[model samples]
Target: MPAEADPASIDAGAALADRGHGHRNEGLAKLAVGAIGIVFGDIGTSPIYAFRETFAGHHQLTPDGLHIYGVLSLVFWSMMLVVSIKYVTIIMRADNKGEGGSLALLALINRVSGNKRWTAPIVLLGVFATALFYGDSMITPAISVLSAVEGITTVEKDFAPFVLPLAMGILAGLFAIQSRGTEKVGQLFGPIMLVYFVTIAVLGIVHIAADPGILIALNPWYAIQFFLSDGLTAFLALGSVVLAVTGAEALYADMGHFGRNPIRVSWLFFVLPALMLNYLGQGAMILSLTPADAAVAIQNPFFLLAPESLRLPLVILATLATVIASQAVISGAFSVTQQAIQLGFMPRLRITHTSASAAGQIYIPVMNWGLMVMVMVLVLSFQTSSNLAAAYGIAVTGAMLIDTCLLAVVLFNLWKWNRFAAMAMLGIFFAIDFAYFGANLTKVPDGGWFPLMIGLIAFTLLTTWAKGRQLMMARMREAAMPISIFVDSAANSATRVPGTAVFMTSSPDGVPHALLHNLKHNKVLHERVILLTVKIADEPFVEQETRCKLEDLGQGFHRLIIRYGFMQEPDVPEALKRLTGCGPAFKMMDTSFFLARQTLLPSSRPGMAIWREKLFAWMLRNAESAMEFFRLPTNRVVELGSQVEI
Candidate 1:
């Protein structure tokens, strides 16, 4: 809900500054609706496989008596505690500009923790958790779609082989339309999800009617009995039950898009109850089924729970719902990567916006393509939806653990909440999330490689970005001119020009790459050569007055620092506008933003090991343009090429 100035003007000044438009109400409504598409999609569509897998997957819990009731009870309470209470009721309220996610939580922590050593690992964990979310995003579509399509085989055994290819075709078609804005496709998500909820509820209620006693199974005792009765196998079943709440984190992630109230209302009033009912109904079905038909029963639990006549249409609805869930996660991946790059955890890549109204919904072409390839490979490799379940739970549980760690910091330091409150919340969630995460560890051998692989690659990229940034800063500091020398030498000799030539730089010590290279190549300097370095402070956004630290380095080269929080990107011209009143009126007419483009000399420097050196070079090649980074005008911008090994 960025303020509607001219889009062109906004982009020219700063990428995403909180210019919330007059459409607060409109945006809120749209955000709520779109959130259903993105945030709750995975969790909303969970009934498709969660129960089915718990009773049938590798853990091999048979559908019988207390096992059936106990598992259903567990799923119900898990959704209530994990999704509805924990996230929707509590966490979603803690939004940063209507945005809720790990980053938002981390931002809150940084504001609170100040100078603690915990900050570094907290940030790394947040970034890694986000990386894991991407892996889940890619896998969700493959598994969900594959599961829904596989329902076809139960209705008609001959159609079994076509499920994977059909799922692939649908996925291919789904991604093919990314260039088209979400406005059109997104409209269907709300009403379709609404119908989806009603249908699953109705289907489940029909079964629940036959056995009203099934409702009694919702108690914690049944859940405890299931744990006591079944032991490790039942405890391990949490890996699959946890799947039901997989996309619950999205509720927070898409908070900015929908706002807190809508998501809260939607999940609490509608989505939660419907999911629980459907899950309970699945349990009831197992209670009625004979042991011999148990394998057949778990294979298609939702369909089997319903009258045989209603199976096909139910399958269709489930498929659509699952597809929508997948769509949300994929979009989430794009958003997180964008945030990572802006905050310096990742290399910047092309971010293409398809919609004018929704700045949040962007298409990262590389991310989209990368996900599609991995998802397709997952579908082809895993084949069955049950196999993909192992990969799914571990990533989600890992993210949940990270969230708890960050929340502990938030409660204790950030919010300054009491130790008891912090400990109580952390202990409860930690125990729940950690147990499931530990349980999911067993999934590693059976197709869990998917999330692990994606997380490792993503973690590597993020760490490399940090290391590269350090190397760049170190190199700049080494080559920098001492302020005493620069003032003594250039202060009296240089000619003063008309306007500011803001040299976006890495360090304040030496002459900036742009300043040195501009003088070397063009033999000209502006009236004010402002050396600007935007440092991402621990907090979310920098305060206005503290935004810039200006030093008179004389010779018209003002060594300047534009400080920003990881949540804020510095706007050079806007920053210059504020700095103007300090001395003279600095107009845009004569001002230019100069940037230094460092093309790595395929190197033999003492900077890094050979492999890392090559990795940095590869990353640099794929990175977004410096002009774009500095928010510089294309016409007046100058990029002077320099060589750096690290």
Candidate 2:
């Protein structure tokens, strides 16, 4: 779970210039736009559920005017305190390299701890949280689209017949677009999300002006009253309510792309306030309306609160906003899975590149299909947006709780911030988030089993993949011919073909998986066989003066290991450029990057049990490929695919 994030180098321009682009500010801006835009979708759509579920989720509060006031009060303060204060204001600064996510946080902890003692438990928890996140990703679009489309049912009772299918169709369309990278589509996300906020705020304001007095739900008393009156139910209600603020984790995850500032400004100045005002307005309407009108109002509460003439346009705006929310969650799943694979928590798979310039833009065909299938099943099985809401928050709330724990480590252990100050701030966050987490627990039996089951399956797969890699690595090391011996032997017998072939490896002392596979399959060896391993030193960028070490073995076989800092991409080409003067002159056009492609096959050996083998295999088949992973040139890259039973 604690994957090393290759922190973004401040000298991204230097790397880009070598690659071709002279100035990278354009690419950087595009990256910022797409990444931040795609990331905000899930959290952006919370208003759809946050307020509605607070008043109507599993532990349904009375639709009475007073309860609505209390619920809205809880929702507004929760956003202000939990989403704005805890995350956007304070936690966004806790970034590793430029990368943000649970795994990134885990890496930061490892850097601070300076030991492997916390690795096992912390990593397991992070991977499980990531797996659960996929469940959230799948369900987000389903519920958002369903909830918005169900608006038709409010206008026409017969529209209920087509709501579920229509929602499924929209979800299917959304997933289908995964084959197309978000670079083009993502350009519109920020502005669109901005519009979504404005549209919802305007709708809320129209209602609030009609009944402005209900704005007093801003009082802390109503929020307290709800908890006192509903007792445990109010606490349980907090889980679904917290869904309004679901994207706080993504805010951290995408910090590197947006450089932490734009997102902070966007959330604090625009997104947060708009969301709160809308929720407050919803509360105001709910509090003023009679109980007899409760069912009717909530049926299209968001629209019902609006004037009759503007209702149709509001529906269109809501639908577009819902689409953006769904899209963002889907993209986050891709980024997280990529990190998981790199960290050794997941197996290898066929990841494809959809865009040329945007390295972050990738498409995983298997994952896309898998998500589509799950979303379809969820829609078909649940049969209603409200039912799907039951299962939605547990994974999201659980993730938020995990983030808090990770933040605690960052503040005290990493930053060495004062414990008294850190603990005081974190304690308030812990209480509020845990309360929401407890609220989500009430939803488990109702419909929350889905994410838990997915998390368990995912956790098992992740654990198995990690353990299997460890055992298999030990086996490979044991079976590997020592560098001195293999070179001595191959120096005499192996055919020396033209040009250089660098086999990037995990360990330079042992023979690479790709070298062995190439020699076995094609029965050809490059004239110069360079076994290269990139070691990460604890710095931002490794200096050229001491970037690499080259050992000249007998004949054409040589061993090279490049050392980098925490904040640099593993540019095989760049590393090759630095390796030229050390004895073997590497020519870019003439050289081929031989990469080992492991097709995971779960074996009943010391690595992974049979059940876990299936999970690892499934994960491998769904994972992104090594092509884009190592930033190798497509034509010059040769993949030696081999099977490893985990």
Candidate 3:
């Protein structure tokens, strides 16, 4: 027999494996707890207004047993089908290298699709979905905080006058604290949300016990009976029922932060059960009341779930949860903006890293202030969460529909799932998405116009920026000299200075504009010349060992390409330090970085409309400079300006 393994060694090996597996499970548990705090806050807070709005909203309905059970049935099945099956089970699996979002997913699909005929349309859909998110971001904070503060009126009728001012003050404070980072505040999120979810679940259990018949709504027939009994009213009620699942997309968008299993665990085991329990209790409470009493209670069913003594405390807790919900959406806006800039869909803006330890903790000043102003305007204009509710579902439903479209591409093209199985699944998604979107369209005259207007404006800006950047790059490439010719001619003709000169270019194959300009003006070349190009890959991150691609073009000229992920911020100086084989080590004092500043001269070219061209030029002018964005030293930088028409 071959030499047998030592018994003690084998036992030790098995014990080590067991220890490693235990650690992984422990880590996943911790992440799941954290996900309950951050990822579920948006949907968790929906119970505060979702059920009440369905009966007392713009198209009000009577709170009779038929309507009550039917609406509850719709809410439960909607979450199970939309939030549970579609997002948690299926879409979460389409993560791009463990990252998920509209832009992240688009990049992944674009890379895999190659140059197929359908690629361009798919990109437009992704960009439009991102644009619609800006509208959603502005409305979330406005409506969440407003609904929470309005609970004060439920506590004391006299407190009604102060609601608007108090809500505005709290919102101002929340936005004010954004520049100071949220790492410390973020630590308390999980525990507080856990308490909120448990409290709501207990409140539901108490009411649900009193009228257990309300649990019969869990059957799907009640939902079908709802539509068949009153088709038109039920169709319009969809606009409001959709609110219960408003933040369902957060599960997929935030999957990168906390992995799929943890978010799934938080939803399946903790968050979803708590949300449905509260909805059921709300329905049960209405059914147990007299007609006149139900009418008054339906005005604020969420707070009335508690006894008189506890309502005030519950109001405070709900307000805090709403604030936390607002914070998550605001931070999401910053992340999406960063991704847009890196992928060339938008111009660069200043990004400040709030935490030294966490790369994802970023603050964008422009986005923060802009959102604050729009939110304040909305709160003032709408005056009540009921009114804001009319403006909400359009953006959310539109994005959901677009996501379904993108999922079609993923199923048939990327994953190559079974055709019949995929089609059946997609059919359910499309039908649900269309019903909600169509219902929301009926509210356009009553405040739904707000998000649609915002979406249209945002989509125009996003598409214009993307098209302008593409045209500008193509024009520059057409005029660029071949790198091989430039190296041979410049190496023999110019004076060789002592230090290294690094010229930044967008393309790896062409000679940079700054290099040509420096040659004509300065009449000298450094001994070590580097043509550096930074390429952002179609993924969330690139490994360190594969980041730098160095090619020596002979005659002391080297072409360096540094690859980064869309989620990463580019630090040119730091990346250069890790690079070797191009020559001597880089030193800040000795090395000079040359950048080209392009001034757009918009002409009647066959590219974009005159109006869009003007808008693109204005955007380019206001963009943050490359030196700050790339983390370059101010002292050792030279900028050469050139004019280009697109």
- TM-score ranking, high to low: 3, 1, 2
- Output the lDDT of residue 238, model 1: 86
- Over 253-365, each residue of candidate 2 has an lDDT whose tens digit, in order, gives 76655656556666766676777778767776776777777755754566675676766666677778788878777777777776666566766555777878766667777
How many residue pairs clash in all the candidates, one count each?
10, 5, 0
For residue 235, what is the lDDT in candidate 1? Answer: 77
lDDT tens per residue, model 3, 1-646? 1224356744543332222212234576788887888888888999999999999998898999888888999999999999999888888877776778889889988877777889899999999999999999999999999999999888899999899999999999999999999989998999999999999999999999999998998988888898899999999999999999988888888877777778888999999999989999999999999999999999999999999999999999999999999999998999999999999898999999998866888999999999999999999999999999999999999999999999999999877899999999999999999999999999889999998898899889999999999999999999999989888888899999999999999888789999999999999999989999998998787879999999999988999999999989999999999889988899889999999999999899899998999999999999999999999999999999999998
Q: What 10-residue stretch in candidate 1 is worst by lDDT?
A: 13-22
TM-score of 3: 0.96
lDDT for every model? 0.75, 0.72, 0.90
**Tens digits of lDDT, candidate 1, 1-646:** 1122354743422222121222354554564555566567788778888888887887878788788888878887888878777776666555444456887676656554565776788888988887788788888899889998988876788998788889999999888777575777888998888788888898889888888789988888999998888888887898888988888788777765566666776777777888888988887777777888776788778777767687888888889988888788777787787677766778777777777776566787888888889899988888898998878888888987887777676566545688887788778888898888988988899877779888888887778777777787787677777766765665565555677777777676667766667666665556666777777664445679788888876566676788875544556777777884345766776778777878765456676677776787789878888677656667878777788755
The RMSD of every model to the true structure, in order and in angstroms, is 5.6, 4.9, 5.7
| Residue pairs clashing, model 3 | none
Root-mean-square deviation of candidate 2: 4.9
TM-score of each: 0.88, 0.86, 0.96
lDDT of 2 at 276: 72
